[model samples]
Target: MARTPADLLADALRRDAAAPLLTDYDDATGDRVELSGTTLANWVAKTANLLQDEFDVGPGSTVALALPVHWQTAAVLLAAWSCGAAVLDTATEDDGRLAEADVVLAAQDRLAPLEEQEPAELLGLSLHPLGMGMAGYAGPARDFALEVRAHGDFFAPYQPPDPADPGLLAGGVELALGDLVGTAQGLADRLGLRPGDRVLVDAGTAAEAGPVAWLLAPLAAGASLVLCRNPDPARLLQRAAAERVTATLGVQIEGIRELGRPA
Candidate 1:
């Protein structure tokens, strides 16, 4: 039987609980955050609980993601899948597809524009390192950071996700949960990612390559991510060395093999 994305995450949690799963850096903001497999799973649990309890998201439900490639974005995507819901990529224009989502999770910057769409449930994420609420913004949407903290650390979904259910909705394409896992694994293999590989990626490339490259590929390969946003080219070599990056996706670094491309 083909495993679901959630299952893969769970396996990572059990196998490498203490290993660093994600190291996020935003050079433009001078912000950095690292999450271990266990910590990442805990965040996923809390977000999943919030989705299932507050919004009644479950199998067949759709959650539109309007955020960028940040650490919090990973939690939101995993949480939606944990609740047996399909994740709709709203980063790209898709006509009226976003309007059909049961829930919309957007960054604070996108609230005003999304308000016009009037989704059934809108959640605004601060994307702050401390997970704070949006400042001075009076909006109809719920605050994701504030609400997620109130949820439990561990999640046991009332109904587990079915492998056959739609897991991803992107630009008119709907991929099943099993298909998502399969493709992720295939991408990982094609990239020659080995276990324990540390893959460095830039936010621009992550956003452009979609979730398969930014998120699932690393997970499927048993590798970790060093996700950099607004990276300074001058400091790229230093950062890659500090992170012990074995491979790179978006940016080319000296002495590191470029994944999915010839060195």
Candidate 2:
């Protein structure tokens, strides 16, 4: 069993690197992307290297994030965890403390206000389905998509993260990094998640559920994820069928098991 976010990904790679681990669907743009376990790990490694080498993000560092529910967001999160850095997600927190973070990564749309906070270091994610650079934007923040590819696809943190270190800060609540694995397992059980289960979750629900439920729980359960953004209500059933989803969050589909308000 995985004891950390990094361990969860390593376990996935050990099990079947080629297996699809995360599939993203954007109804608004009709975008679909699939990431195998190996591919996702590679991204995580590259991003982790960037964080540790460039910004000196490691144990005792905090990375502030103002991004949405997306695959790239997943990579950034796992990377931060791999470095043993705590995350202050703006999705659930205030910009008042964003400037206190060592590094801040934000989506283009959310950049203006966060930029105003004058973080020590700022990076922008295009959130492109194809991992393209931010287009038609002139900004001071460095581009994450371009910088990450230059890093190696393997990571070894200079300072190993201590399990007792803070892991996440959201809604004024704190959780230690060591507790994440256990919390995820408990959430998985509450949601009735089983190994190899396919979960379909909408972006709204995922955002509300936060990373522990929408991201870590599925990983902890050894379940693959199918995340939908800007979900079109009419296509829910068809999309769920196409994804072979056994469980759903934040949406009701006939015959599919909902996460039962656990998220």
Candidate 3:
């Protein structure tokens, strides 16, 4: 069993590098992007390198993630952990946690409120479908897309994080690196996730459930994801069929077995 998210990713690379790992769909904007295991790993490697080389992020560094449940968010989370840094998810900006972080990664639209707080380091993400840099905006934050490209395609942390070291800080929850991996494996089992399973998840649920449900669990179980944002009810069945979805979460599709339900 994997002891960290990075280990889970390495396992996937060895087991299914060519398989589709993430399929993101935004019903509101009609945007869709698919990433294979190799592609996702490449992004993760680049992100980890960016955090380590440019920002000097390593073991014990704390990164506040303020982005939505998108594919890029997954890469950021994995990269942070790979560097042995702790993640503080201020998705709701709960209790001004972002002020406590050593670095902040936020979407462009969320940068306004954070500007006043003035975190030591801030990286703005456009969340563009093509993963492009922010357009025509002068902000106090660095552009993630622009800086990330300058980093190497591989990462090697100067100091690897110990399994018992802190890995996440969310609200009142504090989890160690080992705890995150353990919980991920448990959640995967509870959801009946298995190799070759293409799990379809509602984006709203992914956001609400946090990384454990929508990210780590799938990786730990060796499964892929089809994350749907603002899914149209009328087209849900057709999409599921076309995607060959084998399991689901957050949406009640009659014939599709919901995760954790009795078989």
lDDT of 1 at 71: 94
> By TM-score, how accurate is candidate 3?
0.96
lDDT, model 3: 0.88
Worst 10 residues of 2 by lDDT: 89-98
Note the clash tally of each candidate.
Answer: 0, 0, 0
**lDDT scores for all predictions?**
0.89, 0.89, 0.88
Better of 1 and 2 by TM-score: 1
Candidate 1: 10-residue stretch with minimal lDDT? 90-99
Structural similarity to truth (TM-score) of each candidate: 0.97, 0.96, 0.96
* Per-residue accuracy of model 3 over 36-90 as CA lDDT, tens digit each: 9998888999999999888888887899999998999989999999999999986
Give model 1's clash tally.
0
Q: Spell out the clash pairs found in candidate 1.
A: none
Model 2, CA-based lDDT: 0.89
**lDDT by residue for model 2 (65-172), tens:** 889999999999999999999999867334688889999998977777777778899999999999988887787889999999899989999987777888899888
Q: Can you give the lDDT of residue 226 in candidate 2?
A: 94
